[model samples]
Every structure is written in C-alpha cells, then in structure tokens.
Target chain A: MSLNDPVDDETLLEVRDLQKHFKVDEGLISSLLRAMTGSESDYVHAVDGVTFDLKRGETLGLAGESGCGKTTTGMSLVKLHEATDGSIRFRGTDLTDANEEEMVQFRQNAQMIFQDPFESLNPRMTVYDTIAEPLRIHDIRNETARVRRALEFAELQPPDQYFDQYPHELSGGQRQRVAIARALVLDPDFIVADEPVSMLDVSLRAGVLSLMERMTEEFDLSVVYISHDLSLLRHMCDRLAIMYMGKIVEKGPTEDVIEHPQHPYTRSLINAVPVPDPGVGRERVELAGEVGDAIDVPSGCRFHGRCSEYIGDICETEDPPLEAKADFDGSQKVACHLYEPAEGVDSTRVDDVTDTTAPDDSAASAND
Target chain B: MATQDEPSIFADLDDSTVDESEEQVNRWKRNLRLWRETLGEQWRMLTNDLLVKLAMVTMAFFMAVAIFAPFIAPHQPLNRQYETDAELIIADWVDPMFIDSESVYVLGTTAEGFDIFSQLIYGSRAALLVGLLAAVFTAGIGTLVGLTAGYYGGKIDDTLMRIVDFLYGMPLLPTVIILVALLGPSLWNIIFAIIVLQWRSTARVIRSQALSLRERPFVKAAQVAGASDWHIISRHLAPNVLPMSFLYGAFAIAWAILAEAGVSFIGLGDPNRVSWGTMLQSSRAYAALDFGVWWWFVPPGICIGLVVISGFLIGRGYEEITNPELR
Candidate 1:
C-alpha cells in the first residue's frame, strides 16, 4: 500500500493532480462593446488537484456531497471534460495530451454510466437500438450479436421481449438496466458510474446496485463509483475517497476510513450516516455553514470555514498537504491540520477518535 | 456408476442458458418491446386529441391540393391562355349560363379577364413552396448556430447571442422591405428576405432549449461515452431538439407566408406570376368598391384566411404531439 511499493502493476487507470476550472463570463455585447465594461469574471474549480488510481478489477468509491467535483473528476478521466491541468494515464497513455483519435481508442476501453434513469436513455431510441448504437459507432459489425451479449450481461432475460421497448415503457429500474446494458455492450474494462442508482426508487436501487456488483465481478471491471450514499459505498467499494470542496479530504480502505476517519470533514460525513439499530443511538455531526462557492474556495483548508474543531491561525493561513496518518496501513491519506503531528499534542490524541454509535432500528436512513 | 457417468440431454439446454449472447439478445428484445409500447402510448395520445386530428386533416388537405394543383384545378391558373379567360374562370361552374361559355372556370373571373379561381389554385403552389423553403433555411441556420453556442459556450455563446440581439433590435418589416428593394422583387428574393429576417427568432428559441438540453444527464452520458462533438450534436442533441425545431419551423412557415403576401400586396412580388396578393392589389387599383365588384377581393381574402388559419392549427397540433407536458 505504500507509494514505493512499485505502483500496482495491475493499475488500469491513474489520475494525477487533475483540475477543471470553468470560466463564467458576461453577455456578448457588454464584454465586446467596451474594452473594460468591468464584467467581473469567476472560475469554478470543479476538480481541483484530484489524484487517484484504479487497479484492475477494483471498485474505488468516490463519496462526496453534491458539487464536491467527484463527477467532474470522473468526467476528466475519460476526456469528457477537458482537464485544466494534470495527467490522466489510461493504460499508460496520457489522456490529457491525447488527440481526438487517441481518445476514441481510449473510449473502447473506458465507458460511463450516468446518474439518471429517466433522462439518461435517449427517449427517441428503442432499447435494441440504444444498446446497438455503441456497437455501430465502434464498428462492431456483428451488432446483433454484441447487443445480445450486452443485454445478457445486464441480466435482462428474454431480451427479445424488450428489444423494441422505449425508455418510457420501462420502469425506473428497467431503464437503468438498459443504460448499464448499453455501457456493457462495448466490453469496456473501466467505467465511471456517477451516482447511477440515485434516481431510482428505494426498492429498485438495491437491485441495480446488486446487478452492478455482479457485473463488476463477472466482467473483471475496474470502476470508480461516485455517490454521496456512504452505506451503499460501503457495500460496493473496496477503497473509498471522501471528497469535500473539490478536494479529497480522506481516502483509504473502505472499512478503515469508515471506522477511523482522520479528517474532520470525513469524520462528520461518517458520523452523519444513520444506523439501523434500536438499542444504540448515533451522534450526528451537523456541518456548521453552507458549502462555499467553488469560485471562492476558502484560503487554506477548504473545509476550515465549516470545520467545528478548526484552530484559528493555521487552519486559515496554511494549506494542509495530503499526508499519511500513522494508524493507516500506509494506504490511507488525509488532508487536515488536526491529523498533523504537533509539539504539545500526544501521538495517541492525534487520532482524535470520536464516539461511534449505531442508530435506532426505527430511524430511516436519510436520503443523501 | 454407469448411470452417474452418463451425460444428460439437458446439458445442452443448460449451456444455452448460460450463453452470454443469448441472454443479451433476450434483453435487447425485451427493451425493444418496451420502446414500442411507449410509442404506442404516444400514438394513442396523439389520435385521441381532437385539436391534433383537426390540424392533421387541415394540413393533409392543403398539402394534397398544393401537390396536385395542376390535375385538381379545372383550369390551370398559371396558364392564363387555358380555355378560360378572366371573365369565364371565376363564373359559377354549376350554372348552365356560366358553363355555356365553353371556357369553363370552376371558380370565376377577375375584372381584367383573368381567371380568379385558377389564379387562386396556382397561387397556393407559390405560397407553400416559399413557406416550406424559407422554414428549412431558417431552421438549418438557426439550429447550427444555436447548438454551437450552447454546447461550446463562453466566447462563442456571447458573440452569437449578441448577433441575435442586434437582429432582434432591428424592425423586421422595414428591414425586409429594404432588402427586397435592393434584391429586386422576386419569389426567391422574398423567401431569402423572410429567412434572413426570421432566423433570429428561431435561433433565440433554439439557444434557450439548447442551454437546458446541454446540461441534461443524457448529454453528459453521451460525452462520457466518448462521443465526439459532432456525434453528440447530431445524435444526442439533435433528437432532443428536433421536435422543437419542427414546432418552430411551422411557425416560421406561417410567418413567411404572411410576409410573402404582404410584399405582394405592396406590388413587390414577381410581376408575371399571379398570387392572392396580386389579386388584392389589382382589385384595389380597379376601385372594386365603386364598381360593386365584391368577387375580386372577397375570394382572394378568403383564400389567404384559410391558409393562415390552417397553418396555425397544424402548428398547434405538432406542439401537442412533441410536448407531453402540454398534453
């Protein structure tokens, strides 16, 4: 797990310090009519210096609140959103510099599953055609065969019955299964599934999640599963990264991070997950203020404004670098001053373990 | 031991069951069935709508007449020398006295010996051609510009939107008049004027839709699927925007037809070709009111009203078909 352990030879994808900044501008004439209309401009640093690597057949969960840039980071990996800086190496080929043709080849190996079941499938396309579309684009001449294979992989039995079905005719879960089938038709090795089950009903969500889980194993697929649902991430991911304000606040083995989160933001997120046990009541760590805009991220630690345990000076003036906490098995990393070893603070106190309790069985899991 | 070692016939069935391709085929077939079901639903909704059915009938009738104007009309309107002269063309076809002229015109005759009924029938050909062609021109140009601006955004969006603003500022009627004067009063010239003057509105509407559609999860899905910009625009974006384009195209055609008539009424259309507007102009010039010749003005006015009203009805029908929220 250490950085020097000859970086996993099985690593299928690697993202290093990726960033995407969108520039907001004023209307056309106002900006053009006068050289200086003083049209104030701002940059939304959607994915700011996010770094991660995906091992072959491993599911790395990107858990974060909305607007934390997990989706943007996922997009940058496939060259969907052009990265402002940094390198995305897919099978050792740098995606940041890959021309359109190179990216097309890269796409054969990497694909994506979107968040919404309602809107993700093209309404104009039938199920058969929707799944066949990728095969056509990729020049898979045996489109019927490939589509059939993909639909099978998605577990939609008696595929003939649903071949001509449109999105609206299918239930929410069925639509998502079709979306997954479309993605799987290409036989891609890697996938960025951005909250693929977020739009489904509670009952249907588990079915899609389980299907994805089974497919991941059956296909030997490497995936970056992005979602704000911590429990679901626990169920599906091998390693999980907690993102806050477009930065990875903490990341490690799923069990390790959830059981022992080093960053205060990660701790708060873990604390917020409701437990389903009647005997024990869980303590909630409510976030202090609203999330600051991406354009004006706080100076030092982006979470300083919202961190309840913030120590004034260092938290504001100096940014904390992502470093390994001692208790972690060398794989875990956290970016917070609280985890940083201090002169007066004892090493044991540095962990700052919080009271962990299970929630009442009667309490429903809060929707993220 | 022999029985246990023997291979079972059901092994082949099990193999087929586990065959990945077969499973996929089944899934695909199921999805297709579902899609057809949805389309069936949409069709049922469309058929049940009274307004939609009416519009469809009106459009079908107009288009049929426009297409077969030569065969359907008793006298060829464009062929002025066809048996009927102006006096015979508009006379009542059922009357023995009118039919006795042997130059039978189903509708009637104009004041200047031109066939009023024939002219009206032929005039439809010109009106429909201009309206349809102008709509194509406007929709094509507007959709291209709007898609690029909304998709790429930033500087391109700003610049394109400014151009739209400038066009919006200009008075459409005066601008069309000036352009027509410079370009000369021809049918094609009039169509060109209508397209140029009207494209701005289409672009504005398309841009607004594009702005919203561009952000949809499906658009993002296409992007992450590694679809090129052209692929995304044509496949993902175009299908979503097409219904809107068709809806707006209908409205644009209506506008173009009105503009064509307006120009012709002002005596700016092809001088040789007969149109409803020419009939109006000539009727006014001849002082129809003073002579008590109601036939000249009334027939042409009624033709114009029928076309415009039908166009509006058809456009409404299309809106209902594409927009489920409206239904």
Candidate 2:
C-alpha cells in the first residue's frame, strides 16, 4: 500500500532540509517599533524547512496557498535563491556543495520554468533569442535546429512565425509556451515549474498544464509542478506534497491524497475546491483565525492557531511530524496530532505500529 | 462571453480592411503599429511637455547652425583682415555689432580683425561635435562598465563602483582643465579629458539601474539557462538599461558641452579653433572687456547657455517617458 516507499526508480533529485530565509532590515524607525513590540526576529522565513524527492520521469506537484513556500521550495531546489541551509543531490551528486563549474553543469541538466509567463520572457528579445539562449549558453551551437525543435515541442508550431516576435506581441498562453520552449531548448532532465500556469487564464491553464504532462513522457523529464490548485495538481502530478507555511504537512500518491486527505490543512484545502453542483455543499473545515506572521512563527505546531482539529495542549506544545498515516501503511502521510495514537485519537488508526519519534520517523515520505 | 463569438459590428467595412490575404500589407501595418506603440509614446510625451518642446526647437536651431556653419558663416572663421598686422583691411576699432550689406563682416570685427558672426557660427560646430561625441562615448563606456558591475555583483561591482566613487570625489571641471593644460590644446585631448570625467555619472546611474534589473525574474531565467556573465550583461542587462542610457546620454551631452566651454574659456581648449568658449577666452585675452566691446563675449556665452539648456530639457523629457513615477 505504501507507494511512496523509497523505490529504486532512477531518482533524479533529493532535496533535504531546504531553507531560504530573507532578512528584513526595515530601517531605524521600524527597528525602534519592533524593539518596543518585543518581536523576536527580523527574518522572513520564506522556506523554513522543505524536503522532497524527485524521481526521473515523474511529476511531483507542490501544492499550497500563496506565501506557503511552495514557490520558494521550487526556487531553492534549482539554487535560484541559494538555499540558506540544505542539501540537494542530483543523481547522487550533492548540488548544495557544488562549485561554479559544477553549478553550471547542474544548471545545464536542470532548468526552471518561472510563474509569470508575461514577465519572465525578456520583452525586448525575439522568441528566437529567448529559446536560442539556452542552446547558445550550453554550447549547443546548432541553434536554428535546436530552437526550432524546442519551439515545436512547446507547441508553438510554424516556428518561423513566432521566431521574430517579441513577448508583448504574443498572447499570454503563447508567452507561457515560449517560456516552456526556453526551458526545453537545453534538453534538461529535471525542470522545476514554479506555479507555471498560475498567472495564465483559466481557459489556457489546462492546455499548458497538459503540455507539461505531455513533456514528462516525451522528454523523460523529472518535473516539480508547484501550484495551489488541487484540481490542477490532481490532473498533472503522480505524487502530491501539500505545504503550509513553509512545511510539507501531507504527501502521497496524488489520487490517494486527493481522495482521502489526512492532514487537517489538506482536507480544508480540498474542501475549499468548488464542486459543480451548488447543492452538494462541502462539509468544509471553516478555518477562521489570524494567520501567524512568518517573522513571529508560533511555537510547536505552526498551524495550531488556524487548525480546526485543535488537539488541545498536544497540538499547541508539540509540533506534529509528517507521519505515514497508520491505516494507509505509509502510502499517505499527515503532520497532525490527531493521527498519533499517543495523543489519544484513533481517528484513522491501524493498530499496527508503536508510537514513533517525529523527526527521525518522517521529514518526508522515504518513497522506499 | 468570447470576444470572437460576438458578431462583428464592422461587417460593412471597406474591402481592404476585410482582406486577410494581403500579407505584405498586414506585415507593414504590424511594423508600423509596433513602432508607433514604442516610440510614438515617447514622441507624444516629448510634444506634450512644453519645456521639452521648447528645448527640441532650440536644439534643432543650434544643430542646424552646426551643420550649416560653412554656408551661414559670413566669412571663414580663421580669416583675418590681414596676413600681417600692417595690411589690416578691417580695423579692430570698428563699432561692435555693426552690420554692413557691402562687407562680409556683418557683426563688425573682433580685436583680431576676424568676423565675430563667422566665429560664432563655426564655433557651433565644435560645441555640437564635442557635446555629442563625448556623450556618445560616455554612454557607451558607462553602460558597458555598469552592465558588468551590476550583472556580476561582489568584487566587480565593488571595484567599478569604487572607481566611480573616486572619480566623483575629484573636481571634474578643474581636473579636466589641468589635464587639458598638461596635454596641450587639441580637440581630441579636450574630448579625452571630458570623457574621463563624464562617464562616471552615467556609470553610477546605470549600475544602480542594472542592479535592480539584474534581480528581475527574466534575468534569473537567463542565469538558470546557463548564461555566462558576459552573456547576461550584454543580452539582458544592456537592453533593459537602454532607456536610462538615452536619458543619461542627453544629459551627458549638455554637461560635456558645458565642460568644454569651461575648459576653453580658461585657455585650455584647442588653440587652432574658435569655439564659443575660445571666443570668450580671446575676448578676455585682447582686453575687449576693458574696451566695452560687449558684443564680442555676449553671443558665445548665450550660445553655450542655450545649447546646455536644450540638452537638459531633452534629457528630462526622455527621463519622464522612461520613468513611470516621473510621468
């Protein structure tokens, strides 16, 4: 039942303890105000701790609301923001310690697809230059053929038509396609798509997402598709990892996670998704509480304040570890006290295992 | 509702409008539209700003003077009344600003017995040339250095910015004069001094611009694509910094002209030519001020002022268009 077990299916990237925190030096006046208010830190914990595995020829969806660190996790995986502290291994080579030469090699193999299609492509550059750039950089000098190939792959057919056009002239969907083409030109094995279709129109979103899905099989690519849309993730991802405030609270096979979300946060997110029939209202966990500030993160469970399944002092004092749910036998993982038998909730119990340590047991599903 | 699903209101439009097969015409129209969208916006702003419009007119007028110097000049600028003082045809003592239909000396004559009007016209050419050439060179060098510094942060940024800081602390005009004085009077040397002092401001401004732009997602995407430092700087940073380059170029031209005028005014100019600055210098040298010959100095000074002001206006107009907050 544990599909997430560490299978020997050609692992491409293993991102562990990925953290990217930005210091906010908000002037003398703000410092004075902070001093008076007794604030602890002046840091934005953008990606406090994220851990995930990317298998070759697999699409992993990172789902979370805005400011939940999904994008940050994706960015740091490619060393875009420079992981504050973590290890990212590519095919067993530790990328976190990679020198410039090695980093360049890593970049050649792993490309990034940014969120904003319109803003990510240089407005001044023609579509040819945008796609041709990666080819030129990686020393793939046969530019015309490669750029044309990439363009075709991105489904911008009649490559000649789009070759000379700038980003402004292209439609939003076309622009995103060009971005995909730019990422594809290098023939990279791994691609981190950070909310790739988030800024795209609802009508065009499905097309781009499916194109990404098509790319996985075509190129044999290991892709991390980061988005907040559960439905979109359902369609695109083989495995899903739901993040909340810079931590992955639940992760498993996409279908299983969507069907039976174990984490309180994941359940709320799934419930929030609009159903076609208005009368079939969701028995949603109506979370109504102040979202905790990133700088002043709450002790114990970060989600305890807004969690509907507030397990009294246990939820408040002991931050729940992401654990493989007892009944599912490691297929579905949830980070909440309710899943722990020691915390007195046999809500979704199996009675198969003893109480396990938090950190050692699960930072991420081992996928063994 | 879908935009294409809606029935076309212009069903009865002209044949040309409906002809989708006229590909060449359509291509030309597209080109026109793109050009109009980019430059037309700036052009519209230029015309809209009263000060900028006035500046453009003034610049056009002076540019015309520079271009038509050979034809408009009443007499050759180097022309003296005599090869030697003994054979002087026009007297130095002739009334200032005296115009005569019979003589080429429309603005009378200077103390050197050279036509003042001719000198002013010819001087326009030097002013425009130095101003333009210096500004162009400055913008080019500054932008290149800036792109390198900003795109490649840390040591390169520190070193280049420190150099700019060093240059900034130096009194630009005074140092230029001293350098020119040492190098001797020549147009190229004057240009060299101005350029050395000129590009610092452009570099500093562009460096900051490049810094902000280097952080943009597009640039990061380029980095993720395995683009080298040179590739990022040239392809990404340079193009984005172009609008600012233009803004600075105009301003630099104005400052260069002023700097040249100041240099020549202090007798550190190309002694062979009669720029507006040199004309003023000559007036002082000949003690024309002592003789109450006000016409000799006034024309050149006004020309320098007008040229510099025009450059400022044009630059400001450009800045307004490029900077959204300013607009």
RMSD for each model, in Å, please? 8.8, 9.5
- Which one wins on TM-score? 1
Q: In model 2, where do residues sit more than 4 Å from their true spots? A: A1-6, A26-42, A99-101, A327-330, A341-356, A359-368, B1-91, B94-107, B115-118, B144-201, B262-273, B281-295, B298-327
Model 2 per-residue lDDT tens digits across residues A1-368: 24535577877888776788988767768888888999754788888767777777888899988998888888888777788887789888898777787887788888899889878999778898788777667665445666777787788989988977989999999999999988877767889998888898999988897788887876778889898888888888889999888888888889889998878788888998888887895686877786689887787778988987675776666666665555444466677767632334342333111133453223333221
Q: What is the TM-score of each candidate against the true structure?
A: 0.82, 0.78
lDDT of 1 by residue, A83-197 (tens): 8987889878898777777777787778889888898888877788788777666655555666666777677887877877778899998999999988887677888898989
What tens digits encode model 1's per-residue C-alpha lDDT throughout B1-327?
A: 002232321112233335557656865676677657867976676658676667667667777877888887766554443234444553331222254465455445555556667677778777888888988988888888888888878789989999989988888667777888999888888888888878887788788878888888777766666666788788777777877787778788778888888888887887777777777887787787686666667877886777777677767767887876775
Give the top-scoring candidate (DockQ). 1
Candidate 2: pairs in clash: A4-A367, A5-A367, A5-A368, A6-A367, A6-A368
TM-score, chain A only, candidate 1, equals: 0.87
Q: Please, what are the lDDT tens digits per residue for candidate 2 over residues B1-327?
A: 002322222122233433444544754665577666768767987799899899999999999988998989867887776534578465564554344454445666888778888899999989999999998999998998888888788789989999999999889888997888788889888899999988898898888988888878898898887787778887888878899889889998899998888889888888788899999999999998898887889989999999999999999889887887987
Candidate 1, chain B, TM-score (2 decimals):
0.78
In angstroms, give how far residue A276 of model 1 lies from its true place: 0.9
For each candidate in the order shown, give its overall lDDT on alpha carbons.
0.74, 0.80
